[model samples]
Target: MTRRNIEGSFHLSGGDFTNAGAASSELKSILTNLGINPEIVRRAAIATFEAEMNVIIHAVAGVMYYLITQDTIKVVLNDMGPGIPDIDRAMTEGYSTAPDWIREMGWGAGMGLPNMKKNSDRFKLDSVVGEGTTVEIIIRIKEGKTE
Candidate 1:
Protein backbone atom coordinates (compact mmCIF):
# COMPACT_ATOMS: atom_id res chain seq x y z
CA MET A 1 0.00 0.00 0.00
CA THR A 2 1.05 3.60 -0.49
CA ARG A 3 0.48 4.45 3.15
CA ARG A 4 3.10 3.87 5.84
CA ASN A 5 1.40 0.71 7.09
CA ILE A 6 -1.82 -1.23 6.81
CA GLU A 7 -3.54 -3.05 9.64
CA GLY A 8 -6.39 -5.57 9.77
CA SER A 9 -7.90 -8.37 11.80
CA PHE A 10 -9.75 -11.64 11.21
CA HIS A 11 -11.90 -13.64 13.59
CA LEU A 12 -11.60 -17.43 13.79
CA SER A 13 -13.71 -20.21 15.23
CA GLY A 14 -12.39 -23.59 16.27
CA GLY A 15 -13.68 -26.59 14.28
CA ASP A 16 -14.96 -24.31 11.60
CA PHE A 17 -13.10 -25.94 8.78
CA THR A 18 -15.56 -24.59 6.27
CA ASN A 19 -14.05 -21.12 6.43
CA ALA A 20 -10.66 -21.84 7.89
CA GLY A 21 -8.46 -20.46 5.14
CA ALA A 22 -10.49 -17.37 4.40
CA ALA A 23 -8.31 -15.04 6.37
CA SER A 24 -5.11 -16.09 4.71
CA SER A 25 -6.63 -15.95 1.26
CA GLU A 26 -7.92 -12.46 1.87
CA LEU A 27 -4.52 -11.41 3.13
CA LYS A 28 -2.92 -12.86 0.02
CA SER A 29 -5.25 -10.93 -2.23
CA ILE A 30 -4.46 -7.73 -0.36
CA LEU A 31 -0.73 -8.20 -0.64
CA THR A 32 -0.98 -9.13 -4.27
CA ASN A 33 -2.98 -6.01 -5.03
CA LEU A 34 -0.47 -3.96 -3.08
CA GLY A 35 2.29 -5.17 -5.43
CA ILE A 36 4.40 -6.96 -2.87
CA ASN A 37 7.20 -9.19 -4.12
CA PRO A 38 6.16 -12.70 -5.06
CA GLU A 39 8.63 -14.36 -2.73
CA ILE A 40 7.64 -12.23 0.20
CA VAL A 41 3.99 -12.75 -0.53
CA ARG A 42 4.50 -16.50 -0.68
CA ARG A 43 6.24 -16.60 2.68
CA ALA A 44 3.63 -14.41 4.31
CA ALA A 45 0.86 -16.50 2.80
CA ILE A 46 2.35 -19.72 4.12
CA ALA A 47 2.88 -18.36 7.59
CA THR A 48 -0.50 -16.70 7.76
CA PHE A 49 -2.36 -19.81 6.62
CA GLU A 50 -0.54 -21.97 9.11
CA ALA A 51 -1.35 -19.61 11.94
CA GLU A 52 -4.97 -19.39 10.90
CA MET A 53 -5.30 -23.17 10.70
CA ASN A 54 -3.74 -23.58 14.12
CA VAL A 55 -6.40 -21.37 15.63
CA ILE A 56 -9.15 -23.14 13.77
CA ILE A 57 -7.99 -26.53 14.90
CA HIS A 58 -7.05 -25.84 18.50
CA ALA A 59 -8.79 -22.78 19.87
CA VAL A 60 -12.39 -22.21 20.83
CA ALA A 61 -12.11 -18.78 19.31
CA GLY A 62 -9.43 -16.39 18.18
CA VAL A 63 -8.36 -13.38 16.18
CA MET A 64 -5.55 -12.84 13.78
CA TYR A 65 -4.06 -9.38 13.49
CA TYR A 66 -1.95 -8.30 10.57
CA LEU A 67 0.24 -5.29 9.94
CA ILE A 68 1.75 -4.60 6.55
CA THR A 69 4.44 -2.02 6.08
CA GLN A 70 6.97 -1.04 3.46
CA ASP A 71 9.52 -3.30 5.08
CA THR A 72 7.60 -6.23 6.44
CA ILE A 73 4.40 -8.22 6.80
CA LYS A 74 3.53 -9.21 10.35
CA VAL A 75 0.64 -11.38 11.54
CA VAL A 76 -0.20 -12.28 15.10
CA LEU A 77 -2.81 -14.96 15.83
CA ASN A 78 -4.21 -15.00 19.33
CA ASP A 79 -6.45 -17.85 20.34
CA MET A 80 -8.61 -18.50 23.40
CA GLY A 81 -8.43 -22.21 24.00
CA PRO A 82 -6.63 -24.83 25.99
CA GLY A 83 -3.18 -23.31 25.88
CA ILE A 84 -0.16 -25.31 24.95
CA PRO A 85 1.70 -26.58 27.96
CA ASP A 86 4.88 -27.38 26.08
CA ILE A 87 6.04 -24.88 23.55
CA ASP A 88 9.19 -26.79 22.73
CA ARG A 89 7.39 -30.03 22.04
CA ALA A 90 4.79 -28.23 20.02
CA MET A 91 7.51 -26.78 17.88
CA THR A 92 8.67 -30.18 16.86
CA GLU A 93 7.82 -31.05 13.27
CA GLY A 94 6.08 -34.39 13.76
CA TYR A 95 4.16 -33.66 16.92
CA SER A 96 0.48 -32.87 17.12
CA THR A 97 -2.25 -32.67 19.74
CA ALA A 98 -5.13 -32.73 17.32
CA PRO A 99 -7.91 -35.15 18.13
CA ASP A 100 -8.66 -38.30 16.13
CA TRP A 101 -11.64 -36.68 14.49
CA ILE A 102 -9.48 -33.85 13.22
CA ARG A 103 -6.87 -36.27 11.97
CA GLU A 104 -9.54 -38.26 10.19
CA MET A 105 -10.46 -35.12 8.36
CA GLY A 106 -6.90 -34.93 7.01
CA TRP A 107 -5.34 -32.27 9.21
CA GLY A 108 -3.08 -31.87 12.22
CA ALA A 109 -0.06 -33.77 10.94
CA GLY A 110 2.08 -31.60 13.21
CA MET A 111 3.74 -29.35 10.64
CA GLY A 112 1.85 -26.19 11.43
CA LEU A 113 4.30 -24.48 13.76
CA PRO A 114 7.34 -25.67 11.90
CA ASN A 115 6.02 -24.38 8.61
CA MET A 116 5.23 -21.03 10.18
CA LYS A 117 8.73 -20.77 11.59
CA LYS A 118 10.33 -21.86 8.34
CA ASN A 119 8.52 -19.23 6.34
CA SER A 120 9.02 -16.39 8.82
CA ASP A 121 11.97 -14.08 9.01
CA ARG A 122 11.07 -13.69 12.64
CA PHE A 123 8.76 -15.81 14.77
CA LYS A 124 7.62 -15.76 18.36
CA LEU A 125 5.11 -18.03 20.10
CA ASP A 126 3.68 -17.75 23.59
CA SER A 127 1.09 -19.76 25.44
CA VAL A 128 -0.37 -20.34 28.92
CA VAL A 129 -1.77 -23.72 29.85
CA GLY A 130 -5.22 -22.38 30.57
CA GLU A 131 -5.16 -19.08 28.76
CA GLY A 132 -4.36 -19.35 25.07
CA THR A 133 -1.67 -19.05 22.40
CA THR A 134 -0.24 -16.13 20.53
CA VAL A 135 1.92 -16.61 17.47
CA GLU A 136 3.67 -13.73 15.77
CA ILE A 137 5.17 -14.16 12.35
CA ILE A 138 7.08 -11.52 10.44
CA ILE A 139 8.18 -11.82 6.84
CA ARG A 140 10.57 -9.16 5.66
CA ILE A 141 10.06 -7.61 2.29
CA LYS A 142 13.06 -7.10 0.12
CA GLU A 143 15.30 -4.25 1.26
CA GLY A 144 14.53 -2.24 -1.83
CA LYS A 145 11.56 -1.78 -4.19
CA THR A 146 8.95 -2.07 -1.47
CA GLU A 147 6.85 0.94 -2.17
Candidate 2:
Protein backbone atom coordinates (compact mmCIF):
# COMPACT_ATOMS: atom_id res chain seq x y z
CA MET A 1 0.00 0.00 0.00
CA THR A 2 2.24 2.74 -1.23
CA ARG A 3 0.88 6.12 -0.23
CA ARG A 4 0.98 9.32 -2.23
CA ASN A 5 -1.58 11.83 -3.44
CA ILE A 6 -3.02 10.99 -6.85
CA GLU A 7 -6.16 11.48 -8.92
CA GLY A 8 -7.71 10.83 -12.32
CA SER A 9 -10.98 9.82 -13.96
CA PHE A 10 -12.15 8.11 -17.14
CA HIS A 11 -15.54 8.70 -18.64
CA LEU A 12 -17.05 5.94 -20.77
CA SER A 13 -19.98 6.37 -23.07
CA GLY A 14 -22.66 3.81 -23.61
CA GLY A 15 -21.81 3.02 -27.22
CA ASP A 16 -18.47 4.67 -27.69
CA PHE A 17 -16.88 1.78 -29.49
CA THR A 18 -14.96 4.05 -31.81
CA ASN A 19 -13.07 5.58 -28.90
CA ALA A 20 -13.05 2.76 -26.41
CA GLY A 21 -9.38 2.79 -25.62
CA ALA A 22 -8.83 6.52 -25.54
CA ALA A 23 -8.97 6.95 -21.80
CA SER A 24 -6.73 4.01 -21.12
CA SER A 25 -4.25 5.19 -23.68
CA GLU A 26 -4.16 8.63 -22.14
CA LEU A 27 -3.59 7.17 -18.70
CA LYS A 28 -0.85 4.95 -20.05
CA SER A 29 0.86 7.94 -21.55
CA ILE A 30 0.67 9.80 -18.27
CA LEU A 31 2.00 6.85 -16.30
CA THR A 32 4.83 6.39 -18.74
CA ASN A 33 5.76 10.02 -18.40
CA LEU A 34 5.79 9.58 -14.65
CA GLY A 35 8.57 7.00 -15.00
CA ILE A 36 6.33 4.08 -14.09
CA ASN A 37 7.57 0.68 -15.22
CA PRO A 38 6.41 -0.29 -18.70
CA GLU A 39 5.01 -3.64 -17.59
CA ILE A 40 3.04 -2.02 -14.79
CA VAL A 41 1.77 0.61 -17.17
CA ARG A 42 0.73 -2.04 -19.66
CA ARG A 43 -1.16 -4.05 -17.09
CA ALA A 44 -2.96 -0.98 -15.77
CA ALA A 45 -3.77 0.26 -19.24
CA ILE A 46 -5.08 -3.08 -20.44
CA ALA A 47 -7.20 -3.58 -17.38
CA THR A 48 -8.61 -0.08 -17.67
CA PHE A 49 -9.36 -0.60 -21.35
CA GLU A 50 -11.19 -3.82 -20.62
CA ALA A 51 -13.27 -2.11 -17.96
CA GLU A 52 -14.10 0.71 -20.32
CA MET A 53 -15.17 -1.80 -22.93
CA ASN A 54 -17.43 -3.46 -20.42
CA VAL A 55 -19.10 -0.12 -19.79
CA ILE A 56 -19.64 0.40 -23.49
CA ILE A 57 -20.87 -3.08 -24.34
CA HIS A 58 -22.80 -3.73 -21.17
CA ALA A 59 -23.11 -0.90 -18.66
CA VAL A 60 -23.97 1.74 -21.24
CA ALA A 61 -22.20 4.40 -19.14
CA GLY A 62 -19.64 4.51 -16.40
CA VAL A 63 -16.68 6.26 -14.80
CA MET A 64 -13.28 4.98 -13.77
CA TYR A 65 -11.35 6.62 -10.95
CA TYR A 66 -7.61 6.38 -10.53
CA LEU A 67 -5.46 6.72 -7.44
CA ILE A 68 -1.77 6.92 -8.18
CA THR A 69 0.93 6.70 -5.59
CA GLN A 70 4.66 6.25 -5.33
CA ASP A 71 4.51 2.53 -5.98
CA THR A 72 0.96 1.53 -6.92
CA ILE A 73 -1.97 2.54 -9.06
CA LYS A 74 -5.53 1.84 -8.01
CA VAL A 75 -8.51 1.90 -10.33
CA VAL A 76 -12.15 1.92 -9.40
CA LEU A 77 -14.78 1.38 -12.05
CA ASN A 78 -18.43 2.04 -11.39
CA ASP A 79 -21.31 1.58 -13.82
CA MET A 80 -25.03 1.75 -13.97
CA GLY A 81 -25.79 -1.44 -15.83
CA PRO A 82 -27.62 -4.66 -15.40
CA GLY A 83 -25.83 -6.04 -12.40
CA ILE A 84 -24.20 -9.42 -12.37
CA PRO A 85 -26.70 -11.82 -10.88
CA ASP A 86 -23.99 -14.30 -10.12
CA ILE A 87 -20.54 -13.02 -9.32
CA ASP A 88 -19.12 -16.52 -9.30
CA ARG A 89 -20.29 -17.24 -12.83
CA ALA A 90 -19.16 -13.87 -14.12
CA MET A 91 -15.68 -14.32 -12.73
CA THR A 92 -15.18 -17.52 -14.65
CA GLU A 93 -13.26 -17.36 -17.87
CA GLY A 94 -15.33 -17.49 -21.09
CA TYR A 95 -18.45 -16.15 -19.40
CA SER A 96 -20.18 -13.25 -21.05
CA THR A 97 -23.61 -11.71 -21.38
CA ALA A 98 -22.76 -9.55 -24.36
CA PRO A 99 -24.96 -9.93 -27.40
CA ASP A 100 -23.82 -11.17 -30.78
CA TRP A 101 -23.48 -7.63 -32.08
CA ILE A 102 -20.99 -6.74 -29.36
CA ARG A 103 -19.08 -9.92 -30.02
CA GLU A 104 -18.99 -9.02 -33.69
CA MET A 105 -17.23 -5.81 -32.71
CA GLY A 106 -14.57 -7.97 -31.02
CA TRP A 107 -15.43 -6.33 -27.73
CA GLY A 108 -16.70 -9.21 -25.73
CA ALA A 109 -14.61 -12.37 -25.47
CA GLY A 110 -15.73 -13.29 -21.96
CA MET A 111 -12.36 -12.16 -20.70
CA GLY A 112 -13.05 -8.80 -19.07
CA LEU A 113 -12.98 -9.82 -15.43
CA PRO A 114 -10.40 -12.52 -15.92
CA ASN A 115 -8.09 -10.18 -17.75
CA MET A 116 -8.48 -7.52 -15.09
CA LYS A 117 -7.73 -10.06 -12.40
CA LYS A 118 -4.73 -11.31 -14.26
CA ASN A 119 -3.30 -7.85 -14.74
CA SER A 120 -3.96 -6.40 -11.33
CA ASP A 121 -2.13 -7.13 -8.09
CA ARG A 122 -5.53 -6.97 -6.40
CA PHE A 123 -8.97 -7.26 -7.94
CA LYS A 124 -12.40 -7.11 -6.37
CA LEU A 125 -15.96 -6.50 -7.51
CA ASP A 126 -19.30 -5.58 -6.02
CA SER A 127 -22.55 -5.93 -7.95
CA VAL A 128 -26.25 -6.04 -7.31
CA VAL A 129 -28.97 -7.36 -9.58
CA GLY A 130 -31.09 -4.60 -11.11
CA GLU A 131 -28.74 -2.11 -9.52
CA GLY A 132 -25.19 -1.75 -10.80
CA THR A 133 -21.59 -2.96 -10.58
CA THR A 134 -18.28 -1.68 -9.31
CA VAL A 135 -14.82 -3.12 -9.84
CA GLU A 136 -11.55 -2.27 -8.12
CA ILE A 137 -8.08 -3.06 -9.36
CA ILE A 138 -4.59 -2.35 -8.04
CA ILE A 139 -1.32 -2.42 -9.97
CA ARG A 140 2.08 -1.98 -8.43
CA ILE A 141 4.98 -0.25 -10.11
CA LYS A 142 8.17 -2.23 -9.71
CA GLU A 143 11.34 -3.14 -11.52
CA GLY A 144 11.90 -6.45 -13.27
CA LYS A 145 8.42 -7.70 -12.47
CA THR A 146 6.57 -9.66 -15.12
CA GLU A 147 2.91 -10.45 -15.28
Candidate 3:
Protein backbone atom coordinates (compact mmCIF):
# COMPACT_ATOMS: atom_id res chain seq x y z
CA MET A 1 0.00 0.00 0.00
CA THR A 2 1.17 3.49 -0.78
CA ARG A 3 1.85 5.69 2.20
CA ARG A 4 0.06 8.97 2.63
CA ASN A 5 2.06 12.21 2.56
CA ILE A 6 0.59 14.70 4.96
CA GLU A 7 1.25 18.14 3.52
CA GLY A 8 0.05 20.62 6.15
CA SER A 9 -2.87 22.17 7.97
CA PHE A 10 -4.27 25.68 7.97
CA HIS A 11 -6.38 27.39 10.58
CA LEU A 12 -9.13 29.70 9.50
CA SER A 13 -10.98 32.15 11.66
CA GLY A 14 -14.65 32.70 10.96
CA GLY A 15 -15.70 36.12 9.68
CA ASP A 16 -12.14 36.91 8.73
CA PHE A 17 -12.96 38.28 5.34
CA THR A 18 -9.57 39.93 5.11
CA ASN A 19 -7.82 36.58 4.76
CA ALA A 20 -10.54 34.50 3.19
CA GLY A 21 -8.62 32.96 0.32
CA ALA A 22 -5.17 32.88 1.89
CA ALA A 23 -5.15 29.19 2.66
CA SER A 24 -6.30 28.24 -0.80
CA SER A 25 -3.66 30.42 -2.38
CA GLU A 26 -0.96 28.87 -0.27
CA LEU A 27 -2.09 25.37 -1.17
CA LYS A 28 -2.02 26.20 -4.82
CA SER A 29 1.47 27.57 -4.55
CA ILE A 30 2.64 24.55 -2.62
CA LEU A 31 1.24 22.12 -5.17
CA THR A 32 2.66 24.07 -8.03
CA ASN A 33 6.07 24.15 -6.43
CA LEU A 34 5.91 20.40 -5.92
CA GLY A 35 5.58 19.94 -9.70
CA ILE A 36 2.00 18.72 -9.60
CA ASN A 37 -0.11 18.89 -12.75
CA PRO A 38 -1.58 22.30 -13.35
CA GLU A 39 -5.08 21.06 -14.04
CA ILE A 40 -5.21 18.93 -10.91
CA VAL A 41 -3.77 21.76 -8.89
CA ARG A 42 -6.38 24.10 -10.31
CA ARG A 43 -9.22 21.81 -9.29
CA ALA A 44 -7.81 21.37 -5.81
CA ALA A 45 -7.30 25.08 -5.44
CA ILE A 46 -10.86 25.90 -6.46
CA ALA A 47 -12.30 23.36 -4.08
CA THR A 48 -10.11 24.62 -1.27
CA PHE A 49 -11.05 28.21 -1.99
CA GLU A 50 -14.73 27.41 -1.81
CA ALA A 51 -14.34 25.53 1.44
CA GLU A 52 -12.25 28.30 2.95
CA MET A 53 -14.85 30.87 1.96
CA ASN A 54 -17.56 28.82 3.61
CA VAL A 55 -15.62 28.87 6.87
CA ILE A 56 -15.17 32.61 6.67
CA ILE A 57 -18.78 33.19 5.80
CA HIS A 58 -20.52 30.81 8.16
CA ALA A 59 -18.33 29.07 10.70
CA VAL A 60 -16.90 30.37 13.94
CA ALA A 61 -13.55 28.68 13.29
CA GLY A 62 -12.11 25.98 11.09
CA VAL A 63 -9.12 23.90 10.16
CA MET A 64 -8.13 22.71 6.70
CA TYR A 65 -5.98 19.64 6.33
CA TYR A 66 -3.98 18.92 3.21
CA LEU A 67 -2.97 15.40 2.37
CA ILE A 68 -1.28 14.00 -0.68
CA THR A 69 -0.43 10.58 -2.03
CA GLN A 70 0.95 9.03 -5.17
CA ASP A 71 -2.31 9.59 -7.03
CA THR A 72 -4.47 11.94 -5.06
CA ILE A 73 -4.63 15.23 -3.22
CA LYS A 74 -7.15 15.46 -0.41
CA VAL A 75 -8.36 18.45 1.58
CA VAL A 76 -10.47 18.24 4.69
CA LEU A 77 -12.18 21.30 6.08
CA ASN A 78 -13.70 21.15 9.56
CA ASP A 79 -15.53 24.04 11.12
CA MET A 80 -17.28 25.03 14.32
CA GLY A 81 -20.36 27.12 13.76
CA PRO A 82 -24.06 26.90 13.07
CA GLY A 83 -24.14 23.83 10.95
CA ILE A 84 -26.31 23.18 7.97
CA PRO A 85 -29.87 22.25 8.82
CA ASP A 86 -30.36 20.58 5.46
CA ILE A 87 -27.43 19.38 3.42
CA ASP A 88 -29.77 18.89 0.50
CA ARG A 89 -30.95 22.46 0.60
CA ALA A 90 -27.43 23.76 1.10
CA MET A 91 -26.32 21.84 -1.94
CA THR A 92 -28.88 23.51 -4.09
CA GLU A 93 -27.61 26.18 -6.42
CA GLY A 94 -28.59 29.71 -5.47
CA TYR A 95 -29.52 28.61 -1.96
CA SER A 96 -27.68 30.48 0.78
CA THR A 97 -28.13 31.72 4.30
CA ALA A 98 -25.52 34.44 4.16
CA PRO A 99 -26.65 37.85 5.27
CA ASP A 100 -27.12 40.80 2.97
CA TRP A 101 -23.83 42.27 4.14
CA ILE A 102 -22.01 39.23 2.88
CA ARG A 103 -23.74 39.46 -0.46
CA GLU A 104 -22.86 43.10 -0.58
CA MET A 105 -19.26 42.04 -0.27
CA GLY A 106 -19.81 40.23 -3.59
CA TRP A 107 -19.94 36.72 -2.11
CA GLY A 108 -22.45 34.15 -0.81
CA ALA A 109 -24.17 33.50 -4.10
CA GLY A 110 -24.75 30.03 -2.68
CA MET A 111 -22.21 28.49 -4.97
CA GLY A 112 -19.48 27.52 -2.49
CA LEU A 113 -20.49 23.98 -1.62
CA PRO A 114 -21.74 23.16 -5.08
CA ASN A 115 -18.60 24.47 -6.67
CA MET A 116 -16.41 22.49 -4.28
CA LYS A 117 -18.28 19.31 -5.11
CA LYS A 118 -18.03 20.00 -8.80
CA ASN A 119 -14.28 20.48 -8.72
CA SER A 120 -13.40 17.52 -6.57
CA ASP A 121 -13.12 13.96 -7.86
CA ARG A 122 -14.72 12.82 -4.60
CA PHE A 123 -16.60 14.91 -2.06
CA LYS A 124 -18.20 14.35 1.31
CA LEU A 125 -19.99 16.68 3.70
CA ASP A 126 -21.24 16.24 7.26
CA SER A 127 -22.94 18.70 9.53
CA VAL A 128 -24.88 19.02 12.75
CA VAL A 129 -27.46 21.77 13.20
CA GLY A 130 -25.97 23.30 16.34
CA GLU A 131 -22.40 22.14 15.99
CA GLY A 132 -20.55 22.59 12.72
CA THR A 133 -19.74 21.24 9.26
CA THR A 134 -16.98 19.16 7.77
CA VAL A 135 -16.13 18.81 4.10
CA GLU A 136 -13.72 16.47 2.39
CA ILE A 137 -12.50 17.10 -1.11
CA ILE A 138 -10.32 14.76 -3.12
CA ILE A 139 -8.80 15.36 -6.52
CA ARG A 140 -7.21 12.46 -8.33
CA ILE A 141 -3.78 13.29 -9.60
CA LYS A 142 -2.85 11.89 -12.96
CA GLU A 143 -0.11 9.35 -12.70
CA GLY A 144 3.20 9.29 -14.58
CA LYS A 145 3.05 12.77 -16.05
CA THR A 146 2.50 16.44 -15.46
CA GLU A 147 0.65 18.49 -18.03
Candidate 4:
Protein backbone atom coordinates (compact mmCIF):
# COMPACT_ATOMS: atom_id res chain seq x y z
CA MET A 1 0.00 0.00 0.00
CA THR A 2 1.30 3.42 -0.88
CA ARG A 3 1.03 6.50 1.29
CA ARG A 4 -2.32 8.20 1.24
CA ASN A 5 -2.56 10.97 -1.36
CA ILE A 6 -6.25 11.71 -1.06
CA GLU A 7 -8.24 12.28 2.10
CA GLY A 8 -11.51 13.92 3.10
CA SER A 9 -14.07 13.96 5.89
CA PHE A 10 -17.81 14.58 6.14
CA HIS A 11 -20.21 15.03 9.00
CA LEU A 12 -23.70 13.60 9.21
CA SER A 13 -26.64 14.63 11.32
CA GLY A 14 -28.99 12.03 12.65
CA GLY A 15 -32.40 11.68 11.05
CA ASP A 16 -31.30 13.72 8.09
CA PHE A 17 -32.97 11.49 5.59
CA THR A 18 -32.98 14.23 3.05
CA ASN A 19 -29.18 14.21 2.80
CA ALA A 20 -28.26 10.73 3.86
CA GLY A 21 -26.27 9.72 0.81
CA ALA A 22 -24.25 12.89 0.29
CA ALA A 23 -21.07 11.59 1.82
CA SER A 24 -21.15 8.39 -0.16
CA SER A 25 -21.80 10.30 -3.34
CA GLU A 26 -18.87 12.61 -2.68
CA LEU A 27 -16.59 9.68 -1.94
CA LYS A 28 -17.63 7.96 -5.13
CA SER A 29 -16.88 11.08 -7.11
CA ILE A 30 -13.47 11.41 -5.50
CA LEU A 31 -12.52 7.84 -6.25
CA THR A 32 -13.67 8.21 -9.82
CA ASN A 33 -11.66 11.40 -10.22
CA LEU A 34 -8.60 9.57 -8.92
CA GLY A 35 -9.02 6.90 -11.59
CA ILE A 36 -9.58 4.08 -9.18
CA ASN A 37 -10.60 0.71 -10.57
CA PRO A 38 -14.28 0.62 -11.40
CA GLU A 39 -15.04 -2.46 -9.32
CA ILE A 40 -13.19 -1.10 -6.33
CA VAL A 41 -14.94 2.21 -6.67
CA ARG A 42 -18.29 0.48 -6.77
CA ARG A 43 -17.52 -1.54 -3.67
CA ALA A 44 -16.25 1.46 -1.80
CA ALA A 45 -19.30 3.44 -2.76
CA ILE A 46 -21.68 0.74 -1.60
CA ALA A 47 -19.92 0.22 1.70
CA THR A 48 -19.73 3.93 2.34
CA PHE A 49 -23.36 4.52 1.50
CA GLU A 50 -24.44 1.83 3.91
CA ALA A 51 -22.28 3.19 6.70
CA GLU A 52 -23.54 6.69 6.11
CA MET A 53 -27.10 5.47 6.20
CA ASN A 54 -26.53 3.72 9.49
CA VAL A 55 -25.36 6.96 11.02
CA ILE A 56 -28.26 8.90 9.59
CA ILE A 57 -30.84 6.39 10.63
CA HIS A 58 -29.53 5.37 14.01
CA ALA A 59 -27.05 7.84 15.46
CA VAL A 60 -27.32 11.31 16.88
CA ALA A 61 -24.33 12.44 14.81
CA GLY A 62 -21.38 11.01 13.00
CA VAL A 63 -18.35 11.62 10.88
CA MET A 64 -16.99 9.73 7.92
CA TYR A 65 -13.38 9.77 6.87
CA TYR A 66 -12.03 8.61 3.54
CA LEU A 67 -8.42 7.94 2.72
CA ILE A 68 -7.09 6.74 -0.59
CA THR A 69 -3.63 5.45 -1.27
CA GLN A 70 -2.21 3.76 -4.32
CA ASP A 71 -3.24 0.30 -3.23
CA THR A 72 -6.32 0.73 -1.07
CA ILE A 73 -9.28 2.81 -0.04
CA LYS A 74 -10.23 3.11 3.62
CA VAL A 75 -13.40 4.48 5.20
CA VAL A 76 -14.17 5.00 8.85
CA LEU A 77 -17.53 5.98 10.29
CA ASN A 78 -17.91 7.03 13.90
CA ASP A 79 -21.15 8.01 15.54
CA MET A 80 -22.49 9.18 18.88
CA GLY A 81 -25.84 7.66 19.72
CA PRO A 82 -27.52 4.72 21.32
CA GLY A 83 -24.93 2.08 20.57
CA ILE A 84 -25.65 -1.45 19.53
CA PRO A 85 -26.44 -3.53 22.58
CA ASP A 86 -26.06 -6.79 20.76
CA ILE A 87 -23.60 -6.66 17.94
CA ASP A 88 -24.14 -10.27 17.06
CA ARG A 89 -27.82 -9.69 16.65
CA ALA A 90 -27.19 -6.45 14.80
CA MET A 91 -25.04 -8.32 12.34
CA THR A 92 -27.80 -10.74 11.57
CA GLU A 93 -29.04 -10.29 8.01
CA GLY A 94 -32.71 -9.58 8.69
CA TYR A 95 -32.67 -7.81 12.04
CA SER A 96 -33.14 -4.08 12.39
CA THR A 97 -33.94 -1.55 15.10
CA ALA A 98 -34.96 1.22 12.75
CA PRO A 99 -38.32 2.81 13.35
CA ASP A 100 -41.30 2.39 11.07
CA TRP A 101 -40.87 5.87 9.64
CA ILE A 102 -37.37 5.03 8.43
CA ARG A 103 -38.63 1.86 6.85
CA GLU A 104 -41.48 3.73 5.27
CA MET A 105 -38.92 5.98 3.64
CA GLY A 106 -37.48 2.91 1.85
CA TRP A 107 -34.46 2.37 4.10
CA GLY A 108 -33.77 0.32 7.24
CA ALA A 109 -34.34 -3.04 5.61
CA GLY A 110 -31.82 -4.53 8.03
CA MET A 111 -29.23 -4.77 5.27
CA GLY A 112 -26.91 -1.88 5.93
CA LEU A 113 -24.25 -3.61 7.96
CA PRO A 114 -24.49 -6.77 5.97
CA ASN A 115 -24.08 -4.98 2.69
CA MET A 116 -21.18 -2.97 4.05
CA LYS A 117 -19.47 -6.16 5.08
CA LYS A 118 -20.25 -7.79 1.78
CA ASN A 119 -18.76 -5.01 -0.30
CA SER A 120 -15.69 -4.32 1.78
CA ASP A 121 -12.58 -6.44 1.61
CA ARG A 122 -12.09 -5.74 5.31
CA PHE A 123 -14.79 -4.74 7.75
CA LYS A 124 -14.74 -4.03 11.46
CA LEU A 125 -17.52 -2.81 13.75
CA ASP A 126 -17.46 -1.82 17.40
CA SER A 127 -19.98 -0.28 19.74
CA VAL A 128 -20.52 0.55 23.37
CA VAL A 129 -24.08 0.60 24.57
CA GLY A 130 -25.31 4.11 25.45
CA GLU A 131 -22.17 5.58 23.87
CA GLY A 132 -21.65 5.05 20.17
CA THR A 133 -20.48 2.87 17.30
CA THR A 134 -17.65 2.86 14.84
CA VAL A 135 -17.21 1.00 11.59
CA GLU A 136 -14.14 0.61 9.44
CA ILE A 137 -14.18 -0.56 5.86
CA ILE A 138 -11.23 -1.20 3.62
CA ILE A 139 -11.10 -2.21 -0.02
CA ARG A 140 -7.92 -3.39 -1.73
CA ILE A 141 -7.00 -1.68 -4.94
CA LYS A 142 -5.27 -3.47 -7.77
CA GLU A 143 -2.37 -1.27 -8.69
CA GLY A 144 -1.62 -0.15 -12.23
CA LYS A 145 0.10 2.76 -13.92
CA THR A 146 -2.09 5.81 -14.12
CA GLU A 147 -1.55 8.49 -16.68
Task: Write down the lDDT of every candidate, Cα atoms only.
Answer: 0.91, 0.85, 0.91, 0.90
Candidate 4 residue-wise lDDT, 1-147, digit = tens: 345578889999998988989999989999998887888899999999999999999999999998887777889999998999999888899899998998999887889899999998889999999999999998888645331
Residue 44 in model 3: lDDT: 94
Model 2 regions more than 4 Å off: 1-4, 143-147
Candidate 2: worst-modelled 10 consecutive residues by lDDT: 138-147
lDDT of 2 by residue, 22-113 (tens): 88888889888887878888999999888878888887688989888776788899999898999899888999998998889886789998
Model 4 residue runs over 4 Å out of place are 1-4, 143-147
- Could you give me the TM-score of model 2 versus the true structure? 0.90
* Two-way TM-score contest, 2 vs 3, winner: 3
Please give, for residues 1-147, the per-residue lDDT of candidate 1 as tens digits. Answer: 356788999999998999999999999999998898888898899999989988999899999999988788989999998999989999999899999888898878999999999999889999998899999998888665432
Q: Note the clash tally of each candidate.
A: 0, 1, 0, 0
User: What's the C-alpha lDDT at position 73 in model 3?
Assistant: 91
Model 4 residue 39 lDDT score:
86
Model 2: how far is 30 from its true place, Å?
0.8
TM-score of 1: 0.93
On TM-score, the candidate that comes out on top is 1
Better of 1 and 2 by TM-score: 1
Where model 3 places Cα greater than 4 Å from the true spot, the runs are 1-4, 143-147
Candidate 1 minimal-lDDT segment of 10 residues: 138-147
Q: Estimate each model's TM-score.
A: 0.93, 0.90, 0.92, 0.93
Candidate 3 structure quality by residue, lDDT tens digits, 37-143:
89889989999999999999998999999988778898999999899999999999999999999999999899988999999888999999889999999888875
